[model samples]
Structures are given as structure tokens and as C-alpha cells.
Target: KEIVGVTRDITEQTKLQKALEEERDRALLYLQAAGVMLVALDQRGKITLINSKGCEMLGYSEEELIGQDWFNLCIPEEERDKVKMVFEKLMDGEELPYEYFENSILTKDGKRKIVAFHNVLLRNQEGTVTGVLSSGEDITERRTAEEALKRLNEELELRIAQRTEELEAFTYSVSHDLRAPLRAINGFAQALFEDCGEQLDEKGKGYLKRIQEGGTRMSQIIDALLNLSRISRGNLTLSEVNLAEIARSIMKEIMEQEPSRKVNFLCPPRLMAWADARLIQIALTNLLHNAWKFTSLKEEAVIEVGERKEGREKVFFVRDNGAGFDMRYVNKLFSPFQRLHKAVEFPGIGIGLATVQRIIAHHGGWIRAESTLNEGATFYFTLTKGG
Candidate 1:
């Protein structure tokens, strides 16, 4: 009976030892598979175990690293004392200042590398701290890239500010200096037609009329340029604006200008958005005016202003049955002075869509257009709270 009992005890002990060995093998496999460095140190800050990644990062083999003084060997001489003191205090039951931190370590090749480490205190069965287990990731390349990108962004911002100042000076020149000569040209042309009317022939009068028209058109173009420049320079004052009301008012103005034109304008009630009210009004006016102008030849003209949901985003759209443009030229639609049609066909300086785009961008929004030639066009936009 005693021999059978001893045999059973030996069998149980063998099974338990095999289970422990399997668990240890599995743990070693996981440590080796880890991408980041995994390291364990004893209470005296001597390396107890280190994974393959840790050995690779330190430019040493696992056999050379185990049982070595971690701070004296891996840490820089300047930081060695401070790091050792902290580890000693942690093993003596004091809490660490931080569980995660970044520091520089010396590799075996004598190069310094930045490591971001997450550490935990390893404890015994009685809850006494045994040592520290740390997982460290090499972040030297990422930190370097981030610093370079930051400097690049600062340089870009400085350049943008300088360019804005230069543009403002040019705008002032166009507003004051250019307009003075333009006014004189228009004034003298009108004087020539009025004062010398009886003396001049019909051809002379026609020449004066053409000169006046050219000066007037130049003034209009200047005004449009100034308006486009101003759109990008201002601070936006945002409020809850009723887009439906603004659309209705714009359409009303267009209809009043050309009372003979019969057009159908449809706008939903209570369409609201958070935007700069004045800027939004200007954008809507431009879009609706374009729609009204293009639909002039349509016998059954229809324009609609409304909003719809695209997933979680609310998109507002201006749709028109008008003399729509070709999709191939849509890429140039929002560029200033880029006209898809001739000036005779569309009496515009071609700054309207560009101005609308700037306004929408200021409001942290975007705009896009879709059209089929001679069929219709739709301008979709989204507005959010402005900065």
C-alpha cells in the first residue's frame, strides 16, 4: 500500500512539472514574438530576462544581456544614477512617478536612441515587489519626423502671412491708383458725347459711347477682383441662419430685376444652418443669380433650394434647369476669371463661384457642382461652425 501511494505521488509531481514547463515555453514564445522590447529586471536593477527584440535593439545577444547591470550598461552615464535611484525606490515599495515615460538609452554600437517605455512592478505571491517588467518602443524616428513636420508647417505659415501682406498692398493699389484713371476715362468720354454732340458725326458719338462702356466694364472687373480678395481676409461671425429665407430674398430680387421673365423658384421652409450670416447670404445670392441668369432661355424654368442628408451630414443644394455647362470644364468652375461661356453669353466677371468657395471654406465647409449640358446643374454645399 505504501509503494502504491508513493507511485501515485511521483506521477502527480511529474504532471505538474510538465505543465509548468509548457507554460514557460509558451511565455518565452510570446516574448520573442513581441515587436517591442520586453525586459525584466531584479530588485537590484540587474537584468533577469530580456526578449529577442530587446537584445536586437541593444545590439547584444540575450546571453550577454542577462544578469548585467541594466542602468550601468544600457542607460547613459549622465542618467544612470537618477534612473537607478528610481528603480530602487520602486522595488522598496514606493510608487513610480509615472508608469509610462520616454528616455534615451545607449545601444551597444554607441548610438543613442529614444525609447518610450511602459513599466509594471512584478510582485511575488505575498505581494512583495520583486522587480520591474518593461515594454519599450523605439520612437526616435517618429519623434524626428514629427519635429521636422512642425518646422515645415511653421515655415509655410510664415510664407502665407508674407504673401497675404503683399496681396493687400496690391489690392490697395488697384482700389486707389487704378480707379482714379478709370474714373477720369469714363468722365471724359461722357463729356465728349454730351458737349461735342452737335459738332461730331454719328460715328464720333458711337466711338465715345464705346469708350464709356469699356471704362465702365473695367471698373466692374476691378470691383469683382476687390470683392474676391476681401472674402479670404475677414473673420467670420457665425450664427444660426435661416437659409430658406435668404434663398427666397435672393430669388425675389432676381425676379424683380427682370419682371418679364416667368420662372418657378422652389425653396423649402425652415432650412437652417450654423454659418456667418452675411457671408452665407452673399454665397446664396451668387448661386441663385447664376441659376436665374442661365435659365433665361428656358420656356419652363425651374429652380430649387433645399437640404438633404448624406449619412450624418446635412448638405444644402441649389439646383437649376438652365443652360448648364459641360462636365469636362467643371474643374475650372471655381477659379477666379475662368469662364466656361463667353462674356457675351454670360455677363459676369466670373468671380462668383470662386467667392462662394472661399466663403464656404471659411465656414469649415466644402462645395461641389454637378451638371449635364443644356439639361441642368446642381451646386451642393455643407456649412459648419466657423473658427
Candidate 2:
């Protein structure tokens, strides 16, 4: 009888010990969770338990906080008012629940830290508020990041404004000051040739002609550049546009200008678009004209205008069998005065593509180009559905 009673007692003790171990393990696991910093402070604001995150946040070890007064860390002599309201609420029997407060706390190394405190009332089994449990989250990194980003944005805005002013000044100088001298050079050269052509040799006459051509080309380039600049700051007058009609008009104009070149323009019968009508016309004309000029060497020049639904995006491509540039030059293709072909071969200021890109971007669309040397080039872009 005695042996049996002892075994029974041993079994009960074993079960009780197992339950205690399980409870301890669970408490440890709860404290290990990263975001939640479990803490326990007594009625006197004395520190009882500080979890891993709590210690890490206050930049201290649990050894330092335990048994120390927690409120002393928060309410400095000057800022004791921080908790005066908290105490008032507690005295009112209104269990002051989780409240957010930001303050500095002294660390194990005797350094102060600014942390966000989320304090909640901890009650006993009798349903009486016994102590406060606070969660501390260190937001130093986040604050630093936001401050840096704000500074960067401010700097970028200032730089952009300065750059815009510089561009306007340059444009004003180029339009008025630079053109006047070029006009004089060309005009004086023409007069010189008209009066002195009879006394000049073939080479001399050719030199004068070259001077006139250079001045004329330079003027055309200036106009193209100015047009590109206007695209950025100009208000777009949007309207519905029939891309097929625009393509046909551009094709006819090109054909009339260069009738000897055999060019085929395949515009889908029903392709319509929503854009600035005049701007769209200009963009399409430039693209079509570009394709025509690039393919001047090919006996069979072909250009296709078509649209397709790509994933959630609507894409339109202008494909041509032309003297395409190397793909490596793609980045430069949309920059002002950036060209792959010599100005003699392609009579452009290289601002056409830049202007086209600007218009497409203003419509909240993107443009891409694919090409290979001597093969062909295809330019793809998107258009907004309606104005």
C-alpha cells in the first residue's frame, strides 16, 4: 500500500513539472516575437520584466532595467508632466489603456535614446489594474530615412528650377543673338557671290555655296531644337485623332517631295487615337518621314502602322525596313542633338525623336526602339484612351 501511494505521488509530480516547463517555454516563445516588446512595470513604475526587444530598443541589457524604476527613465525632472495625465487617468479608475508617447530613456551605457512607447495597463486575476506593460519600437532608422529623402527631394526641386531657368536663358540667347550673326554671314556671302562671281574660279564659287548651305542648315537645326524645348513646358491641346489619315497625309507629302523613291505606307484602315491632334500629326509625320529617308537605299521600302494588345497595355508600332542604327545607341536616340547618322545623310537636327518621346511621355506612355545595322527599325509606343 505504501509503495503504490508513493508511485501515485511521483506520477502527479511528474505531470505537474511537465506543465510548468511547457508554460515557461511558451512565455519565452511569446517574448521572442520580433515586433512585440513585452514589458512589465509595477504600480510604483518599477521595472519587473523586460523582453529582448525592450532591452534592444532602450539600448540596454535586461540586467540593467530589472529592479530599476521605469518611470524615472521616462519622466525627467523637467518633463514629469509627461505622466501627470497618465496618473490622473489611473486615479479616475479609468484603466489608462495603450497610449503612445515618445521620450528618451537612459541606457546601460548611460546614453539617452528616443523611442516610441506604447503603454498598456496590466491587470491581475482579480480584475484590478496592477501594473503597466509597455512596448517600445525604435524608429530611429525610419526617421533618418524619411529625413534624407525629404532633403534629396528639396535639392532635386531646386536643381530642376535652376536648370529650367538656364535653358530659357540659352534659348533666348540662341534665338536672338546667334541667328543674327549666321544671317549676316549667309547674306554677305550671297552678295559677294552675286557681285564677284564673274571674277571667281569654280572652287571659289563652290566655297561660297558651301557657306550658304551651312548657314541654312544651322538655322533649320535651331528651329528644330526650339520646337523640342516647347514640347516640355507647352500645354497640349488634346483631341481625337485618326492615325491612318495622319499617316496618309505625311506619306503624300513625302512622296511629293521625293517622288523617285518607291515607298509603301501600310496604315490600318481603322486605327484611331486620343492625343493632341496637331502633336500626333507631327509625331507620325516625323516617324514616317524618318522611315522613308532611312530606307532611301532600298528599292523596296516598306512602312507598317499597326496596333496590338500587349498584356494589360495597348501598344502601337511603326515598323520600317530602313538603314537602322545600332541598338547600343538607343539611349542617345531620345536626347536632343543626338544622332547616329551624319547630318549630311539625314537632314535633321536630331530633335525629332526627342520631341516624339516628350509627346508620348506627356500622354503617360513609354517609347522603345529596336533595330539592327542595315536591317530595319521598329518604334513602339502607347497612347491614352481618351483626353
Candidate 3:
């Protein structure tokens, strides 16, 4: 007990323990921090230190970055001279803490990283700029995500093309196989009504005639389905086209689709556009046919085709004074296989407007419809100026 009572100096040991504790805390922070990359450059702008986070941000190991000239290692060669100039400015007691957004940095992995930097100058006691301390942030992932999204959209378009081709093949098979049997039945029924009319009563003759008519109607639908498929699968050959000529041609086509109906087509002459003439003609034909079909109850049908300017864009409209539909169902108007009227009344497969929408999209444009029940309807589309 007497020996243990001897006095001892413990100051050095206590200080050493505190220093060790601080070092351990720093190591823990280095392990946990994912902050903006931290790097320090000496007065000559040589990298004196790059923390763990910095190495990870630039896809480099610590050993590769340390002792390397930070500017030469990361910046583009052309920009290195400017960086040296900036470093000289910093050493001359000038400082810059901010720069523009969306600058690029060459990463160790050979891929470019978009980065933004903020820096502070370290000073000595005599107020000399000794070095630079920088905090850099990486925006590569965001840029990569944007590029990937763009490619995904392109892939989606290609996939749609492939699917449409497959549907066309299926449609061909259905059109051929389905119409053949229907044609045979219709032919045999007509033959019975003509060549064997004396063997059947008036009711039997009426039954045969109804069978032929129903078969003929079904065959007409099959043919319409094929035409609708053609509209969707056709390739767009974009060029400068006159909308007035397209409208005139569409009026003629619609008249052919329904020869008995009287349709008044009004369109301006020499209206110009940048789109595929064939695709636009198809879209116009569909719209005009719809106008004529819906206006069968009216004695006079009025259809107008024209363009209007709207805020750095041009909108073209196909307006009709005919039977319209409810606004509540407008959302489904351009959807494939959706119809506002019954098959018996409208006599279509409901793919016409969908085809028109696809054509507009191919031209980097958009279309919308506005209508009210028992009133007139208008279909509007916009073709971008530079697409």
C-alpha cells in the first residue's frame, strides 16, 4: 500500500487516450458518410487527400486517386489548362465557390459523370492560399436514367410495330377463313331464292333473303376490319404536304364509302403542313366517313377541314354538323375497339380513330375531340413545327 501511494504523472497518458478517441470517431464518420465527395489539393493543386466517399463517387480506389494531380486525373485535357488558370487565381488570393450546373467529369471507369462543385480555399497564417478543398456531387445516375428512359420509349415503339404486324397476319387469316364460309352460305341462299323459288312459299323466300343479307353484312364487317388494320400498320412517309389536297381526296374517298349520302365538304386551298400525306389522308378519310355516317338522319351534312394557330403550334380541325356523342365518354373515343354507337347503327369496327391517333403520334403530334350528345363534333390535331 505504501509503494502504491507514490506520486505519478498521468497527463501525457490522458492526452494520448483523447487523441486515440478522436481518431476512432473520425474513422467511424468515414465509414458512415455518403456526403458530397471530399478532396484536398496542395498549393500546386496536387491531390493530397481523397476521402473514401470521394473515391467511391468517381469510381476510383483511394490508392489510385491519392498523390495524383486531381485536375489532370479527372478533368478533360482541354479543360485542364483552364483549371490551372483557376488554381493560379485561387493562389493569388481569389476564390470561386460556385459554378454552373451540368458540367462533366471523366470518371476512373472511363464513363463521363455530370458533376457540380463547390470549393473553399485553405489559408496559412500569413493569409496565403495554401491549397483548395472541394466538395463534388455526382449526377451520373440521373442522366443515365434519363437516357435509359428515352431508349425504353423507342423500344416500346418498335414493339408496337412488331405486335401490329402479328395482328395483321391474324387479321388476314380471319378475313379469309371467315368470309369464305359466309360467301358460300350467301351464294347458296341466293341460288335457292332464284332457281328454286317455286318449291318454296313466300315465308321461305323471305327467310332465304334475310340469310343472304345477314351474311353480306357480316362479310362487309370483315372487309372493314382489314381496312382498319391497314390504316394502323401503314408506314408514315413524312414530308411537306398540303392539307387542302388531303382534305379534298378524303372527301372523294368518303363519298365512295357511302355513295348515296350527300356530304358538303368545305376546306381551304393550299393549306400546308409537315406530315405524311398518306397517313394524314387516311386519318381525314376516317373522320369524314364518321361525319357522313352519323349524319344519315339529317338531310344536309356539313363537314369543314381547316387549321388554326395555337401558341407556337398549328391545330387542324375536322368539324361536322352531325350526330355527336357524350363528353363523358370522350376519354375512350380514341381507344382501340371502343365505339359510341352500336354495330348495327354505326357499321364499323371502331379502330378508325385509334389508327388516326397513332398516325398523329408518329408525326410527333396529338389529337383531341370535343363533342356533345345530339350536337356536332370536332376532331382537332396538332403537328409540331420541328419534330
| Maximum-TM-score candidate | 1
What is the clash count for each candidate, in the order shown?
A: 0, 0, 0
Model 1 agreement with the true structure over 1-387: per-residue lDDT tens digits: 355443345888899999999999999999999999999998888999999999999999999999999998999999887777777777777666757778889999999989998889999999999999999999999999999999999999899889976886688566767888999899888887778878988898888888888999889878877777787678888888899999998888889988998899999888989988899999999999999988988998999999999988899999999999999999999998899988788788888999899899878899999999998899999997642
Candidate achieving the largest lDDT = 1
Model 1 off-target regions past 4 Å?
A: 1-35, 39-49, 56-137
Model 2 off-target regions past 4 Å?
A: 1-20, 23-140, 270-273, 309-311, 383-387
All models, RMSD in angstroms: 6.3, 8.2, 9.8
lDDT of 3: 0.80
1 or 2, greater by lDDT: 1
Q: List the residue pairs that clash in candidate 1.
A: none
Question: What are the lDDT scores of the predictions, listed in order?
Answer: 0.89, 0.79, 0.80
Task: Please identify which of the two predictions, 2 or 3, would achieve the higher lDDT against the true structure.
Answer: 3
Instruction: Tell me the lDDT of model 3 at 314.
Output: 81
After best superposition, candidate 2 residue 133: deviation in angstroms? Answer: 15
